[model samples]
Target: MASFAVLLRAVNIGPGLRVSSADLRGAADDAGLADARTLLNSGNLVVTPGSSGAGSAADVARLVEERLAERVGQDVSAVGLSAEQLDAIAAANPFPAAARDDPSHLQVHVPFGDLDEAGIARLDLASPGREMLATAAGVLYVHYVDGIGRSKLTPKVIDRAVGAPTTARNWNTITKLRAACAGLASR
Candidate 1:
């Protein structure tokens, strides 16, 4: 069995799409994923496909989405990454200083599709702060130099700029998810 880090998009961020961590874990378990664990209420999950026959990360994501839809009565998009992929994303931290000094200001954006360069350029043009942006391994790393709350780089701006929906996790969350993936892989 291979472990995967599954990220659910746009859940628990607003009033209409609230899903508890327990519910998320139950959904994964019902989806035939083993060792299901949730990192936060924001829908970060780590699990292994036991007898689910999910051959790839994409398949795992699909299964999770289906289960979550059934449980929550609405569609929930998920992006899955294999253990190696998660580790690679963590290792590819472009803003190491930000991650070390101000982890909350460092965000890793995981897009549903490949990031568009033109859109990223548009985003760069729209940036109002000293935010640094980089893309590696199909993920975007952003360092909010001035802090995220006051920044104008909102979710809508990012979605418009990247031409794809993305879910962001701070450096602390990313590292925790990486460690969870490592633990799941070792089991």
Candidate 2:
């Protein structure tokens, strides 16, 4: 079985949507995933399933969407990452030191096929105290000198820049997710 890290988009945050980490694990289990675990309430999941192909990601996403939509009567979406890919993301981290002290630094994971120079240039990321821009790997890496909660660039802003579906985790969370994936693979 291949291991994957899945991030649900725009769910369990403010407003009416409320999905617990236990709910996420239960969804994975219902979808036939093995060794399912959740990182936090923000919808990060580490699951080992029989496959790691994008097709499998799509299936997990569709199942989760269907289940959540049934529960909340609203649509939801998800993005999945292979353990290898997550490891690559961790290795590709450019501002590890900055991220260590500053929880505002984040690694935004964008679909590899959805990145373009023109879209990135249109982000208008010139705000002071927060550095936000699209990276070569299609991920928008950001460092908010002030807390990200106070930063002008929200997750929506980053998504608009990439012009596609995206999910983000702080640098520390990314590293921990990477380790979890790696450990799962070793077993």
TM-score of decoy 1: 0.95
**Residue 54 lDDT (model 2):** 27
Q: Output the lDDT of residue 148, model 2.
A: 70
Clashes of 1: 0
Residue 74 lDDT in candidate 1: 92
List the pairs of residues colliding in candidate 1. Answer: none
**Among all windows of ten consecutive residues in candidate 2, which has the lowest summed lDDT?**
50-59
lDDT of 1 at 81: 90
Candidate 1 Cα lDDT to native: 0.87
Per-model lDDT: 0.87, 0.68
Best by TM-score: 1
Per-residue lDDT of candidate 1, residues 13-51 (tens digit): 868688889888888888888899999789999999987
